[model samples]
Target: MCDFTVAVFRPDDDRLEDAVELLESLGATPVPDPMLAVEPTGASPRDDADYTILTSKTGAELVAGAYPGTDSDGVADGGARTDRWNPGEATLCAVGPKTADALRERGYDPEIVPQEYTSSGLVAALEDRVDGARVEVARSDHGSPVLLEGLEAAGAYVHETVLYRLVRPEGSGDSTELAAAGGLDVACFTSSLTVTNWLEAADERGVRDAALEGLSNATVGVIGEPTGETAVAAGIDVDLVASEATFETLATETVELAAPTYYE
Candidate 1:
C-alpha cells in the first residue's frame, strides 16, 4: 500500500499543527507546509462603529489579545492593540463560528454570526440592518474585497482596519517541490492568498509550470468558492471545494476523495 500524501498550506501556528494532526488521523501522510505568516499591525477595530465585524479567529485574537481574565472590557496587552477597546454599544459580528468563539474567549459577545460563514453571507445577514449604519471591519490585510464592497453596496458606511498582514513564511516552498515531483495525493488550499502564495513560491523556485502540472494530477481542494476561483484562474484543477469553509471539512473531504480506502 502506498502512503497517501496530502499537502496542507497553513500558518506555522497551531493551525498548521492542527492540519497535520487532522490529516494524519485521516490516514494520510501530512505535508506540513507553513505558507502564511502573520504580522501584527498594532491596530484595533474602531469601537465607535454601530456594527463591528471580525473576519477570522486571528483577527479576533489580535484585537482582543490572548490574555487570561482579559475580557473585552479592557484593552488586551498582546497582539494588535489600541489605547482601549470598549465596544460601549457596538454590536459585534463574527464571520463564522470559530471567529465567534475566539471573540467569546476574549470576553466579547458577538451578536451576529451568519449561517453561511462567508463574507457574502455576512453581508446578506447584515444587508437590511447596516443601511446608513457605521460598520467597522477588522481583519488581515488580505481580507476579501467582497466584504467591503458588499457592505458599501448595502448602504453601510464601512471602514476597515488592517489588524495584521499575511506573508509567505521563509523557506516555505518545499511543498511546491514535492508537488512538482508528483509526490502529493492531495493539496488543500484554505484561502485565495494561499493559492497565490503557493504559486508565487513555485515561481520563485523555478517550478511554476511543473508544480501546476503536478497539481493537475493530484486532488486539489479549496476551502471556499473564492479560493476555488483563484485556483481555477491559476490553471490549477480544483477537485473539491469543501461544503463548509473550514480546515476540518476541507481536509476530510480532500482525504476522502483522494483515498477513500485510507480515509475509511
Candidate 2:
C-alpha cells in the first residue's frame, strides 16, 4: 500500500495517459505531471515513398495525418499537403507494437516491427532486405540521424520527417518545486527528449539544483540505453534501465524500482 510518487515528461498523449493509468493502477502518483506536450515541426509523409519507417508511435501518429480517419491525430495542417496522400505499395516499418497500433488505427498494416524495438534494431531488421529502396523515416524533430545514416550505408535511400518537437507549456518548469515538496519517489524518462526537456525546464525555472538533488534521491528509470545516456547528460542519476525501450516496460521497471511491493 505504499503508493510511490513518480514523474513522466512525454507529450500529453492518450497512450501515455493509458500508461499513467497503468502506473496509478500500480500505486504510483505521477508528479510535475505527465501532461508535457510535444509539438510537430510541420513534416509530412510522401505518398509515393517506397517505404515508411516509423520509429515511435509519435512518428506513426504524425504520418496518420495523411489518412482519412486519423487526420485529427495527424500533425497540424499547413505543414504538409497530405490531401491526396495514398500509401500505395509502400511498405510500413514500425519500431514496436505501440507504433504498429497507431499505424493500424490509421489503416496501415505494418510490414515490419523490429524484434529489438530500438533504432539499431530496426536497421538490423530491414537493412539487408531494403537494398536500393527509398525509405521515409518519421520521428521527433530532434531524432538521431543514426537510422538515416545506417539505412543509407546499407544502400537504402532514406527520407526523414520531423514528426514532433517536445516543448514546455508556458511556465511549466515547476518540477523542482514539486519534488522539493517531498514524497516524489520515482523519476521516469521515456526518451532522450524527455530527459532534455526536463533538464531544460528545471534550468529555466532556476531550480535545476533542487530538481537534480530531488531526482538524485529518487529511483530514476529510463526507457532505454539512449534515454539513460540522455538522463546522465542532463545530470540525472539513472537507477533503472528498462530491458525494452517502451513506456509499458518503463512502468514495469518503475514499479520494481520505486514500489517493489506492487511489482508482482
Worst 10 residues of 2 by lDDT: 66-75
User: For this target, which candidate reaches the highest TM-score against the unseen true structure?
Assistant: 1
Worst 10 residues of 1 by lDDT: 67-76
Q: How many pairs in model 2 have backbone atoms within 3 A of each other, for residues 3 or more apart or on separate chains, i.e. clashes?
A: 0
**Which stretches of model 2 miss by more than 4 angstroms?**
66-84, 260-264
Per-residue lDDT of 196 in model 2: 73
- The numbered model that scores best in lDDT is 1
Clash number for every model? 0, 0
Off by over 4 Å in 1: 67-84, 261-264
